[model samples]
Target chain A: MTAPSAVGISRTTRPLAPPRRTRRGSRLRYTLTVLAFLLPSALPLLAFTIYPMIGAFWTSLHSWNLIGVMEWVGLENYTTLLTDDATRRVFANTLYYVVGYLPLVYIGGLALALALNSLIPARNLLRGIYFLPVVTSWIVVALVWRWLLNPSVGVVNAMLGGLGIDGPGWWTDPYWAMPSIILASAWKDLGFVMIILLAGLQAIPTDVQEAAMIDGAGRFRRLLNITLPLLSPSTFFVVVISLINGFQVFDQVYAMTGGGPAGSSTVVVQQIYDLTFRYSSAGEASALSWLLFLLVLAVTVIQLIGQRRWVTYA
Target chain B: MPERIRRILLTAVVALGALVMFFPFAWTVSTSLSPGVGLDATPQLIPDDPTLAAYRELFANTPFARVIANSLGLAITTTALQLTTSSLAGYAFSRLAFPGRGLVFGLYLATMMIPIQVLIVPLFVQMRSLGLVDTYLGVLLPGVASAFGVFLLRQAMNSVPRELDEAATIDGAGHFRIFARLVLPLVGPALASLAVFAFMSSWNGFLWPLIILRSEHLQTLPLALAGLQGQYTTQWDVMMAGSVVSVLPMLALYLFAQKYVIQGVAGTGLK
Candidate 1:
């Protein structure tokens, strides 16, 4: 955009400023150039993301399906979502999922990162092996897990049977369903979390570790004092990103259980999907989306506020 | 504990960890290859009666071939469109100094925080209004403008030397020429990484396409696979075969370009 302004400069200093008209013209050209580059992204995003965002908020206020006359129902959708038992179950299930999933991911990711950072052979191969699941589609992953965890003929049950133990129905059991999905999710995302944390770990200066060692610091003491503190930024990144993603958890749950076992596994996004597309309740769906969005935003804001305590850049 | 024992223990743990991570994928591949194995039977990791029967069954049962084609075409188009817009926007944000630049860039970044699921209802509603539902464009349009890609490439373009663009300008080349000839080539690796990510994301995208694409033939691989899963619930081998068919290309692509993909995410976190 500023390319045209190159014409305005002179090293000789033989003349004063260029014509005000030409200067203004270059600015105009620069503005046009900027817009020209931006339009391709801006136009589609405005149409698809931005416009729909405002539309979602507006639609949340009205009982509108894709067809028929729209009826205004201010706050009713929100009120019902808050008050309804079914929606409450969905909300609580989402909470349980976040509660169950995040800790596993953080602990598992940190453990993997620490282990790999300390010592392991064939590092890239191990990293690839760990990362394999992240590449596979959630549909495939869910189906595979469903087959693995089936009560009657599943491999997991067969192994339990070998030990003279009765295995619970994983996805079909109301109590274990969310936990099972959480486990699968934890497995699916472990690689990404590990990679991020490992990157953070590797970036630590070895001299710091050696300095602690020379000072007769125990391995545990060094890790607690130095490694963990320095690793917090990556940990913070993984936690926030995964938590936001956790709120939107749908693909695996939908593909595996369809939020079944009497809605024990329904997350917020799945509820939104069912409400909008299946039941043609666009207003309710929009309300649920906004609710989910607010939840994610809140969690992100909290994390951002919390990060300064431990997430040291240096 | 001595260093040697510690190393061995760590190695064993890592091996076990990798096994835990990879076992599901191996099971899927094994099951897909070992057709007609019942869930009740003790599953064999390597079947005695290995066959392509499940694949044949998958092909016979669904228009999976067409589904794959639909997915391939949609993913490519989406990637191409995203790369174009992202690179252009990245160039502009990085190189050009214009009024309201920070505001515009901030707006774009804000949209990234809003989950794609949150936009599904209204986005679909908008598409339905425009009669884009059930069309390729309907599915493709929603994924085209990527905030991550723009931000990543902006960082990349910032790393690129401004001297090249200035030199080109001194030779009477315009901004477009500088962008096209000088800036874009320098950011080639970043674009490559962006392409891989965009392709992976569009390929794995389920929610929007499931809502938009109505026809069985128009459905992408994920949607089609979900449909097949609903139909053939207990037919593990057949479903796994279909999963394999859907997953193989991505697996190949990922293994081929693992460094770039990992680097992309790491670079973002570092920034």
Candidate 2:
């Protein structure tokens, strides 16, 4: 992609300058060239990403709605959101979603990936099948799951009735709504995690496994000792991505429950959306969004710190 | 004898797992074909009397066709622009020895780490100010210069040898000529993979489109599908039919290019 003559241009341009040392001149030219390459991307990043983030932090300090005159609250928004009962409940619900979602997706995805990695004849087809939902939009998946999990005319309840067992109102009932969202999210996400794990499995050298086999190691022993250790990097990637995605769980919850059934499934993102767009409480929404940002930042830093011990890349 | 039995059991287990993984899709197809009330009773494995009424209803009542068209247009346009911009920037980063290169690239990748939610408000405000809100350009603008695309393409471009550029230059090719004639053709596979990822992401995108596209005619498939669910009120057969329409193209693309897609994602070291 690089033109060999471009370096010649740099040399010729430098020679055209005064015979004295042109180190400072070349540095200036280099800086301009870098800016030319970065300007398009940097413009958006500044306008959309960084500026808004700082603006959110600033807005969170005040109490302002869409039309009201700005009233400087001085941390009242944060303090109120931190201590309010509804805010506490919403935070608790978000925790419920994370706790419910992470393990199911992580362990379930790992098991599926492992199972598919075994000596299955149609492994490619199976992998494709498992990964199908990953590429589909979550809205479609959520809609379909809502139908299947419907209490009265749904297939799940129908099957339950056939088995002489009663199925609860999956989306309507308070207790089951969050679990239903978790199951739907897991179904949509499992394929992505499995694909990552399968790639990790394929990267594991065959000689390592063969040597273990020659030493009379059984299937389970080799899996425990050799395979698992080599797969840690991919596992770590899956965990990090899944956790970030789980915490940002908005689309499915929005479509499936709308944070209804008495706000049982009201995740932090939904709260932010409701506050900003629905209620026009931009200040509070900004506060809540900043809170989520900090939480995610803290988690990501912890993961990066933790990665030193586990993640191996060549 | 025990080993032989164990092998058979393993086969059974794998088959069962595959079956369960595929069950929801299969059930969706079956339920779409089945007559009304068939989906509610005992969840029949096979439809007793199949009909195309749901498909008919889907086409007749809603703007399903328009939604499909909008999604295709958005996905294709966004992917094309993304590939062009990212390829240019990626080539520059990999081949050009500009100053502040490290800091610039770092800033680009840093944008990837920030959750897109943090940017929504300003982006919306910016779009509103530009009078681009509720337009196709609005959906396509933010994604055209994607950081992940730049990152992936740069990785691929770095592997391309410098000799190719020198040969083209010696043959009297200019910089743009070398880029188009020599560089781009060599990185065809990488470009194709990036295109696939971009297309899938744009096609499956819901949140941005939902927030931006207010007009009914411009609504994408996912948005349209969500609307169908509410308007129909327990008409799943029709909803499933709409979903099938939405998903079929993606399925076809994925099946045909499964190898490239897998290689592309794996190439990113995302695994």
Note the DockQ of each predicted structure.
0.59, 0.43
Question: What is the overall TM-score of model 1 with all chains considered together?
Answer: 0.95
User: What would the per-residue lDDT of candidate 1 be over residues B1-271, giving only the tens digit for each residue?
Assistant: 6999989988898899888777777888788877667646857877877788899999987999999999899889989999999999998888766546689999999999988899998888788888999999889888888998999999999998777766776687887887898889888889989999899999998988888899988999999888987798778888889888998999999988899888887777666
Query: What tens digits encode model 2's per-residue C-alpha lDDT throughout A1-314?
Result: 22123444457444212123346665455446555655666665576677767777777777777456768888888888998887888878888988988898888878878877777678788878878887788888888898789888787888888899999999999999999999888888887788788788888999989999999999899988898888888888877777777777788988899898999899888888788778887788888888887888789889989998877664
Q: Top TM-score: which candidate number?
A: 1
Model 2 residue runs over 4 Å out of place are A1-40, A67-71, A312-314, B1-4, B38-43, B269-271
Give the candidate number with the greatest lDDT. 1
DockQ of 1: 0.59
**Poorest lDDT segment (10 consecutive residues) of candidate 1 chain B:** B34-43
Residue pair clashes in candidate 1:
none
For model 1, residues A68-107, the per-residue Cα lDDT tens digits are: 7889999999998988887888888988998999999889
Could you tell me how far off, in angstroms, the CA of residue B167 lies in candidate 1 after the best superposition? 2.0
lDDT, residue A122, model 2: 80
Runs of candidate 1 exceeding 4 Å displacement: A1-27
